[model samples]
Target: MASSPTIRYGALAQTFHWLTAVLVVTAFILGPEGSEDEVFRGADLGRQAHETLGLAVFVLTAARLLWRLADRRPDPPDVARWMDIASKAVQGALYLLLCAVPLSAVIGTWLEGHPVTLLAGIEVAPMIAASHSLGERVSELHGLLGDTLIWIAGLHAAAALFHHYFLKDTVLVTMLPRWLKK
Candidate 1:
């Protein structure tokens, strides 16, 4: 639990936040090469790695969402009312994207009749019938969502920086690791 009403997040919440951020960023970086069929027609190492990490993102994000719902979040910073609303909206959008991007990829892969190899090499067979056209369309959407996620995540970072540098608030510091705290 937070030590004070507006103090730092619980350790578990902080862990989920940082872990999801890392996995999402990694999955985004590996997306292009991994989604390329030419790079690995029959599960190229890069594609396999991407799929594996994507699955992790999907699972982790779900757990994070659940944790968030069940836990008490720290109160919003003592910013203006509008800033608080904006913060909530942006945070909600980011969470939506965090869940959507990887799930879309999973569906696209399954629709293409490709099995996904999980982190431990556990194979997941495709559930739906193969459809090249539909698969391509979904894949395109997956890519588009990934791009959108990156942009929104950038905006989220910028907002934190704005709070940290301009407002000089704890909004950013609350999420920082202990060593980074002033």
Candidate 2:
């Protein structure tokens, strides 16, 4: 099998990175607003889409992690020690949030005695016993985590841009697909 370029991620890694970003933003936009009852009731396309996208993010993250274990990543551009530490911290937080956001949603929905509704008439029934109050709290936590994820991701993008424009480094370019790298 061919290996990735020493200075750039392979196409698969680039694809996963960009696709995850799109899915996260789209899911955030589609998230239903209102009380738990209002969100769970009726046939809401937005809610269904949000749940589906969240699930997709969770699955994609798992796959990306697995791929990373075997894939050789591009070497990091030369930078200050602090910058490297901050970058790793942000990346770790993003991964944690990616997993937590979806899990909280599932746990919250299940605890509230509701099924996780998805597109194409699919539904995942609650596996845990009902605890309406705790469910509400967990659902609220999910919202907070979602917001945090967006903010951290924004910071990550800004850092990449800074490296690209100010530092004149390959930090961002290393992840760009062939078409975008030109």
Candidate number of the best TM-score: 2
| Ten residues in sequence with the least summed lDDT for candidate 2 | 173-182
Candidate 2 accuracy as TM-score: 0.96
**Quality of model 2 by C-alpha lDDT:** 0.93
Q: Per-residue alpha-carbon lDDT of model 1 for 1-182, expressed as tens digits?
A: 73657556778888888887888788777765544466337545656677888888788888888887888866667788988898889899888888888888878877777777654556789888988679778888989988898898899899889888988888987777666654
Q: Tell me the spans in candidate 1 whose CA falls farther than 4 Å from its real position.
A: 1-3, 34-36, 119-121
Instruction: Show the colliding residue pairs in model 2.
Output: none
Per-prediction TM-score = 0.88, 0.96
Q: Candidate 1: minimum summed lDDT over ten consecutive residues — where?
A: 31-40
**Over the stretch 60-124, how does candidate 2's per-residue lDDT look in tens digits?**
99999999999988889889999999999999999999999999999999999999999875999
| Per-residue lDDT value at 103 in model 2 | 98
Per-candidate total of colliding backbone pairs: 0, 0
Instruction: State how far residue 149 of model 1 sits from its true place (Å).
Output: 0.9
